[model samples]
Target: MRNSIARRSLLKKTLTGLGCAAVMLLSPLSLQIAHAAAPEKDELKLGFIKLTDMAPLAIAYEKGYFEDEGLYVTLEAQANWKVLLDRVITGELDGAHMLAGQPLGATIGFGTKADVVTAFSMDLNGNGITVSNAVWEEMKKHVPMENGKPVHPIKADALKPVIEQYKAQGKPFNLGMVFPVSTHNYELRYWLAAGGINPGYYAPAKGDIAGTLSADALLSVTPPPQMPSTMEAGTIDGYCVGEPWNQQAVFKGIGVPVITDYEIWKNNPEKVFGVSKAWAEANPETHKRLIKALIRAAMWLDENNNANRQEAVDILSRPEYVGADAKVIANSMTGTFEYEKGDKREVPDFNVFFRYNATYPYYSDAIWYLTQMRRWGQVGEAKPDSWYFDVAKQVYLPEIYKSAAAELVAEGKAKAEDFPPASDDGFRAPTNEFIDGLTYDGRQPNAYINQFKIGLKPDSLL
Candidate 1:
């Protein structure tokens, strides 16, 4: 009887210990389930170019936003925009920091015939055009001056004389932008053509994609991070690129940033977060969660009248991030922009993220890029405005954004007052802030295109 009791007691103790062990092992997981944390697709690899707008990714990782949702993310720096896009399409990267026009261009089959989409816009107004000191010295002659300072929103007409000089010398006045399909390319071309500089054309019908057809100033491709290097090598006279590259030029004292894209088109959309359609489809919840983190990061970047800008600039300067000098990053980030040495100007909108409804991907913004592509013959055949609408729908995912935004409100991570009302339309109010005095209404895109003195209109395709 004694042996029986001892054995039973021992068995009872062992079983109790096993139950306790099970409870301990499963408690954390049960809490994860109870909270409905992010899924088994927790391990991720995201890519970014070395630019300030890549801040969301950096901030999310640094602040453990990804971890809060039970994700372990690896952020990689891409070689170039093309390589980055290719990686996203081929599933080499789960997603990436993409040019505003990349998904639009890719979806329309202009460059790579991939079905890419963006639900999150990374930033706004973070790019600028910079010229070598030598080029600027000559261009300064034509630039309008006030109080001994060059009047800003300086038109490319100022550079026309310099290009003429280059032409007279039997040399091409070369410039650089990150990609041919990039907003920098379009903005640079728009600014030049607006100034009667003839940025030239792309005659893909003739197998010429150099975009220098009938060109006054020849624009070529230079990777964003390499813009300063190529210009410093004297390979190109000037370049249009995003920050801190423009600021990088200033720091090296090799080039001077002439104007920012904010001044190009005030509060314009810049970079976006792009994922393959398949990834978004299979991982809808994870995708929404990712957007939530990014949206919070965007808000944080712009909160308190941009009080966090210095902190963000420091984050961007880290060697693993943008890897540029902090001063270079601050030239634009700190809300004061330096043109020539000691000729600093206050530019409050140099790097907008959450403010001005920037993170929302407007259908009209997508359409504007489409119009530029069509204007330059990227879209070879003329289609109705409905085609523009349909293509814009495919590329920009405002519906997905609405879902994520609505969820953020429901979860109380963000206030209902922070975003547009549930009945809010995708279009921003008509903007008259363009440098050239053109008004843009997202609803009337084609009419706005028609207003342009240059560029292909509805009737001018042939």
Candidate 2:
């Protein structure tokens, strides 16, 4: 781990050449994540998309979290989410900052056939849907405004009238999401549907993965980094993406961010750190150590009312990290977010990586992804509630997270109170923070699914 940390640090220094800025901010006594111990693999490679949520992996490597555990890591930016998952599957990369559904979808053969697992969730609520300034102006008429601001939790209800205008005029209303199984895709769909807009569906059984079945707005996959270009090219009107792409839109003067997922559903789960299940089984101790470092990194990220966010924005701006311009990344990396060109608002929970147990690999989080898959017809078939649990168990490795947190507590690097009780069940208690105000109990997935007006029904199939 020491060698890996040292090597990653050197690589970051070479890539960033960031000068006194990095040196001045290097944390003292703040980087220790675990007791010095033997690491199974000294040199490792990890994969990531160029999104801001990838911060934990970057910070863990740059801050020497891997070294404290005696591991050396290489962070590589993948071209796309699928490529990142493939790299992990083919052992081209050791692990990746992954989509929460990538591991579960892979495990169930929904997209790619492989066994993937996640021990750590990377972040929460770093995603937003943005429209071009032109579109925002038109949609503004339908949106309810009060106190000189758009109402809280802006729904696609406002966008529906705008899309209708395009449709009535025989123009296409195109939108982009990062990937089919990405949280961005599901969140965008959920937002669009809550307002009576059909974003479309997938019918894997019918050999249609384009997800354009009976859609009003055409949804397509655009890599996170390409979202701005795609939108600016008039190829896509808007997109749902993670920072700094949303922030990039504002900086480029090309678009306006309407609402963040945090506003859609408070503190919603986002990305996860995923690896092939085979890799996890082959290096159990190493996997636990990796999760420990990530958990610590997440804790540092959200600590002290996000006091570290400014420094974090600078780190993410470095070419070796998120690599966007500092101002672009800082648009949201700091506590405030940019909506319209100048409507900046304070939204501290927009990128919660750790606080509120955000880093914990809760079974409920995995279950939510499965529900989305079914909702969009990616599942194609329905199963009992237990199937949701069984699938969630396959991808979300909370046991690994618990073991790592326990080790940290034993070493006094972390406290027992920082984690759920040792006897803790994997599921969180029921939650009702959804846009529709429907409660969700992970244990009763069937009942939860029934609450949705949109999506697959029991025993339904394409």
Candidate 3:
């Protein structure tokens, strides 16, 4: 790995030197426009997990968007989310493709206390909940069928009876999520709780971070890439994870994906491009340039009505990136998702990168994650709505995102219409698109938390 990184560095420097020399001769005005500001740190290493949503980083590197911005970036796949976050905090990694909740979780001292911030929201709605074959068989019995096919958006209601049976049989029902603060964890818990199953709670104040207090189904962290095999090994009955892993389960015939996060909440934000607060402070220009490159990559991913998805799948399938089979990655990337075997369905928004202003780091997106953290007892005490807003503003740097996006629009690389309006505030309009049909107004996070039937209510202590 070290040798390969060295070679990549050498090649990037050689190519960048040659490209700069050629561009300098064309026009001084053009050169001034192109070279943003000799990057504070041109050569940098960014980290990612081997999930399909890491496409922005991969696409940025592969399409030379990084080079276009005078940034020499090496995309290194990390062992897992924790390692990836730790590296970014410790300055071993300049930045990383991170879970949207990671920065919030880290900043609030959920797992690791660090001042991590994100200027780029990576993608939206790219995860699914999968159950092992045995659980699927049992769930199939309860699931509503239409024309001999299981209905769409298979609710956790179908999995409730299975958990009951596991308890009756003296078997501990186990489920997996990528990380404690991951959207997968919250989405899985949300689905399970909506169906009247107690997924569990956290009591950090009591020094019990296990998150399995009085639970019907035991939830644990499993790395994204190992989710399928972990289930195959009988360690977890089901899992909520991002794409390719859920699809891998279908291909391996070990499990069946029941529903996607998109079905749970429409166009939900997933991952972000994250850096330490200190890193962003020191490399403001570099950070803006990085976001600029990522914005372009995101537009490319969803451009022309997803005409480039096939190419993205191919690029992601390479060993250096996602390393999954092209067919498995394509199962969800190309505007469709496979549920049960041969149950291919059109889910055009499954892996959104740029459409619907997905890349913008909305403050509402940050607040939603904070609400989930509080709902599950990660935040031991209740916080005011003002506190939520302050934390969201602190962690999600939309000004940086807006600056990068405005530059893109000014350069004619992107359209003003493609972005959120200049007068728009950082919050999206209140949405009630969740599966349970609960309305979420970022301005009223505490009220939203109080509405959840499960989870810790306001003034309720774990």
Candidate with top lDDT is: 3
Residue-wise lDDT of candidate 1 within 166-225, one digit each (tens)? 989999999999897898999998888778787877766667778777788888999888
Task: For model 1, give the 10-residue run with minimal summed lDDT.
Answer: 1-10
Candidate 2 structure quality by residue, lDDT tens digits, 159-224:
999999999999989999988998989999989988889888899888999998989899999999
**Tens digits of per-residue lDDT for model 3, 76-179:** 99999999999999999999999999999999999899999999999999999999999999999999999999998888899999999999999999999989
Deviation of model 3 at 419, angstroms: 0.8
TM-score for each of the candidates: 0.91, 0.92, 0.96
Q: Which residue pairs collide, candidate 1?
A: none
Candidate 1's error at 14, in angstroms? 25
How close to the true structure is residue 400 of candidate 2, measured as C-alpha lDDT?
90
Please give the ranking of all candidate structures by lDDT, highest first, separated by commas.
3, 2, 1
Report the Cα lDDT for candidate 3. Answer: 0.93
Per-residue error for 255 in candidate 3, Å, reads 0.7
As for TM-score, the candidate ahead, 1 or 2, is: 2
- Give the best candidate by TM-score: 3
By TM-score, the candidates rank as 3, 2, 1
Please report, in order, the local distance difference test score of every candidate based on alpha carbons: 0.82, 0.85, 0.93
